[model samples]
Target: MKKLSYLFIALFSLSLMTTSCREQKSTGEKVEEAVEDTGDAIEDAADDVSDEVEDAVDDNK
Candidate 1:
């Protein structure tokens, strides 16, 4: 009976650990996606600023 209880507890603990790992993986993926989106937005803004600066320089010339 004691051995059976131990076996059950081990299985339960293993399942809980696996579930926690999966949750962490999903959260990590979301953070990675958000970072990528932020990078793209920054790049686009930089391009727009560059274009504006070029136009100003041309006008001055």
Candidate 2:
């Protein structure tokens, strides 16, 4: 029983190590995510600027 418990613990630890190692994003994936985030930020900024411009034009009336 004791040997079985040790074997189980070793297998569990090995699995945890392997799964954690693979969970990290590859460099290419990381770069893609960064580009997507930047795109989202730019889009949000454009929307904000557009709203501001509309408000300014309305104020001119």
Candidate 3:
């Protein structure tokens, strides 16, 4: 009975560890997606600024 109990405890601990690892991986993916979205936004803003500058220069000409 004691051996069975130890086995059960060990299995439960292993299950928890696996679940925690999966959660960490999910969190990492979310962070990577956020960074990609932020990078895209920055790129868009830069493009808009460049377009505005080009328009101003054309107006001066």
Top-lDDT candidate index: 2
Give the local distance difference test score of model 1: 0.92
How well does model 3 score by local distance difference test?
A: 0.92
Task: For model 1, name the residue pairs that clash.
Answer: none
> Residue by residue across 3-48, what tens digits does model 2's lDDT show?
9999999999999888754587899999999999999999999999
Model 3, residue pairs in steric clash? none
Each model's backbone clash number: 0, 0, 0
Q: Candidate 3 lDDT, tens digit per residue, 1-61? A: 9999999999999998887443345888899999999999999999999999999999999
- Top of the candidates by TM-score: 2
**Which ranges in model 3 have alpha carbons more than 4 Å from their true place?**
1-25
| lDDT of candidate 1 over 1-61, digit per residue (tens) | 9999999999999998887443345888899999999999999999999999999999999
Q: What ordering of candidates by TM-score runs from best to worst?
A: 2, 3, 1
